[model samples]
Target: MAEALIKKHSRTKLDMTQGPIMKLVILFALPIIASNVLQQFYTIMDTLIIGNFCGATSIAAIGTSSQPVEVFMCVFMGIGGGVSILVSMHTGSKDDESLRKTVKTSVSFTYITAIPLAVLGIILTPVILRFMNVPDDTWDLAVLYIRIVFVGLLGNMGYNMNAGVLRGLGDSSSTLLFLIISSVTNIVLDLLFVAGFGMDVAGAAIATIIAMYLSWFSSVIYIIRKYPHIEFSFLPKGIDRESLKNILKLGLPLGFNNSLYTVGHILLQTLINLQGSAFMAGASVAGKIMGVSSVAISSFSQAMSTFAGQNFGARDYGRLKKGGRIVPLYSALITMSLGIVMYIFAPQLVGFFTKDGMAIKYALLCVHIQIPFQWCFCVLNTILNLANGIGAVRYSTVVNLLMLWAVRIPSAYLIATFWDGHYVTGGVSISFVFGMLAALLFYRSSHWARICRA
Candidate 1:
């Protein structure tokens, strides 16, 4: 029975190295897209539950806490990206031993980093919140939520690492299955804890942590039982110094790029914080709406990363290049269409989060100002992932730094400071467009092409 299950699971991995480009991209991307949409649905449900039961302040607290958590979580995510690239390459080359070694090292690395990072996150949550200038009214709840969420970093990191491994193996369906399970669990728990028990922000955080662990454990079990040939284990004996070195070399830049991007957003958040609680609430809700709206683009970008990674591993540069072009264009069109719908219904969507008229008004303004330019992110995510997929992860770092530091942050600060403070959200949204333009220019410079050719 176990052998049969293993064989069935193994057969499910899509071989990206051989397929019609569009068909392969869509087939690989659809399940991932569905998973992302479901994940977004549960997240929005959490916000809706909080908004309805716990009020806008609780909603704002979760929103405020989410930024710092994302900043910290990006480290693990970047490392996972590194793991996926290396694993995909090895898999493509039919180097089973190397693939197994990479998986072990990646899992070991995730544990080593996650433990300390969780501790540091717990210790630093308050300080980071202060730095973001979290308003007095929202402070205590934000702190509680962040601390609990930080404690679950191990689970979050574990799930992400496992998902990266599956993605590297060209098996997004398994990750999707796990995500659906997690999302459903989270939604039920959110309703029970926050709506039923009235634990408010703390309940939402707890529910999230429990869901994360559930997903992580599911992924771990699936990997162990269904991929016997991979020898999945976290034993210290699995650590390979050279593999670690390679992971860091490819991953550190990607990780830093993500952290740096988050840093830019934190800076923007600080500016938003200065605008007061109503704006904070509005911006918070707007951010979530935008996230939900952009799910398709985000999913496609991730799919492109894995698709390109496998092709790169197989040295199919032609297919990689073709995907690099096609996927971004497709992503942009879909994002633009979604942006239009979101813009038209911005008020209704924002209203779902709060009854506060002021909060709804400001949130509506944020959506109106930002949604039109949302397509730019599709370009940015697609190109960056393509670069990461081809082992030119460092180029992604450079591109992100240039965008966030050189373009986004400075523009946001100047606009918020010199212009009207009310324009801060718009400023940040416009900055994204500018940053994506810069990234597009970098992509067009053919620098990545040169690297791939060499």
Candidate 2:
């Protein structure tokens, strides 16, 4: 009776299925947006520090180094998406036992996957950098940063899995607190290690690892304290086959797609590399600026997934369909508004990173090409996320794969080969429009419904 009382009193429920749809989405998304903003701050700080202390080559190093880890991490993170969707569905259906099992399985999966990937990342860092044809000036910095990050891969991967579970439980608020702690920890450490200790790119990487571990540790404590009934292991006990099956069924296609997609990015990074370090540094700075708008775009998609997950699980097709109409409109408008502001302030923002004239030129050019079409990508993202929530992941996977491989990459190559090698970023904008159209078609066909019934 005491335990039951504790469970009832402690659980903070934001029932996504029952509330006013728009209000609930905005409320959930706000915390996620805040969290993303805080997350972006630390990322920007890393670049700002590198650009200031170590110079443009280091800035390019950071950019090129990240892709190798992202290639592996994206697969695991995609699986975490499966965890969130399942947890949300279970919450909607009020299946306590299965929810507990899914959490345990995710914990186990994280360890099993993270260790192997970390080892592989450490091994491949040098090889991958060479493949990207990293400039001689930036090569050593890129290798150092990539290896340091892989060494602490478990912490970052664990935190992402924890965040997925929290979002699934309709508890975005706790994640904001976690990000708050990590962001502050990261920025302070970045300053102390880089500025005070003169550790350079190595210092930036070290600061990031420590922050990631702390973030993951804090989340574990919070989950244990707040939900005493749901137990977890710091050292994963083992994977549960039944639970793993469910998660993989929803998650594997996503993992495969993300892995392939990031591989495409690695190839794209090769393209960025061929342009030389100055252009690469410029694109990196532009990415940081564009990352601001992506916060809202991603937050909305995540929030809608959680929202749609609950409604779909509860079999509230009406509410889910209703959101399919209203939420995308809100997402597109808000994301586009942010794009306009970022576009207006592009010069000032670019100035914050570096004063190198050529760097500034390439950065601003990429920004100009991408920012105006940002809304199109947001629309596609929101719709795909909605499909994901309802177990229609395979279709979303197909859409993403085609958008990257057939449309985006080909367009970039054709532009470079024929017209202007410098304007490949235009391909990104073209793909955004194409993806938006494809996503709309996916929704209109009600493809997700067949998947749901199956």
Candidate 3:
């Protein structure tokens, strides 16, 4: 029955298993890279508009709000990652029956997980903020932003699930349209709510929430028009047994890792909070600047994973081996090029976020410590994506855990306690070196090498 439905399949624009590795990877990565830029641009606009209109305290509020939101969002991101991996493999093998089931189960999983998490997030927002040691100045704004955003969490998770299906089946460009529309919607609403009506951080949150639903709805309409086999629904058909098993097999570890990973970050955020609101606002600004600079690392990671997943599924070991080596190096070079540009223009870029002198000072301090070594992240990220593409995730999960628990958290605390707290950004940079070294071992002893040989 499921196989019969797949007879209406629409072939992906680029088949991963058949192409020049470099050309195909770049073609596929370009849209994803562009989408990342749009993400950063809107993010910057959020801070720029808020900092200008609402003051530095609001920017600090947003910075505080983000990690709590990420804690809720990352678990579903892992589910999306797992869905894409399975879809790529199933597509590569031309297993239509399993592919259909995976798509169905993905919708069910999203519906099941998202609402409960969202409710939990909203209810716990104040307590969570307090636990993070959010000072009185930024506390109320953080509570308001987080709760409003949580209202749209279901739409955001559903959109990701839909996008994951397309990406897994080798369609990367379509989501770019979704992002553009969302970006436009967000900016326009920001002008109306924040600028015109003076809604402050509340306005920014509302604007982003509306865009989230629009991205999900637009993705649904596109899927229905182009690939009718995919019908994205908030109310799913009863969970398919085989698909549930497959999803859990990959999804659970990845989901737990993502959730825990964000929790680890929340601890780091606590360290940042202790530095005061001016430093918090500055670090937030630096993140936006460096986010754009480091986009290539993440963009290529997604592209490489899809490419590797499809090839691995098709038993095209040659491309897998080749891409694993080539893509990471390309990503590193691109990252460094952007990092150099950001490093040169740091003051101007940081200034673009706000006029506050103290915030600019601390933002530059954070950027100087972090941006120079972003190339290391590129290498580590692409390597793990290679492993993810091939459905060999345990080692990568372990690597991430070790980097956070063993390296980042301890180092961050020690640097703040013993050394100049201004230099604490060095903690993440130090972990990058550690993570890169650990990721390299995936190629050395992992079953991916054995799978390639077999």
lDDT of 1 by residue, 1-454 (tens): 6456546776778788897887777777888888888888887898899989988788788888878898788877888889988888887787788887888898788788898989999999989999999999999999999999988898999999998898888888888889888999999999999999989998999999999999999999988877877778643345888888888888888889889988888998899889888888888888888887787776788778888788877888778777877888988888898888888888778878889998898888788878888898788888888878878787778877877787777777887889877677776566668767766764556666574575
- Worst 10-residue lDDT window for candidate 1 reads 442-451
Clashing pairs in 1: none
Error of 2 at 424 (Å): 1.6
Tens digits of per-residue lDDT, candidate 2, 122-186, equal 99888888988899999998999989999889999999999999899888989899888988888
C-alpha RMSD (angstroms) for model 3: 1.8
Error of 3 at 407 (Å): 0.6
What's the candidate order when arranged by decreasing lDDT?
Answer: 3, 2, 1
In candidate 3, residue 205 scores what lDDT?
94
lDDT of every model, 2 decimals? 0.83, 0.88, 0.88
Clash pairs detected, candidate 2: none
TM-score of each: 0.95, 0.97, 0.97
Candidate 3 wrong stretches, greater than 4 Å: 1-12, 230-234
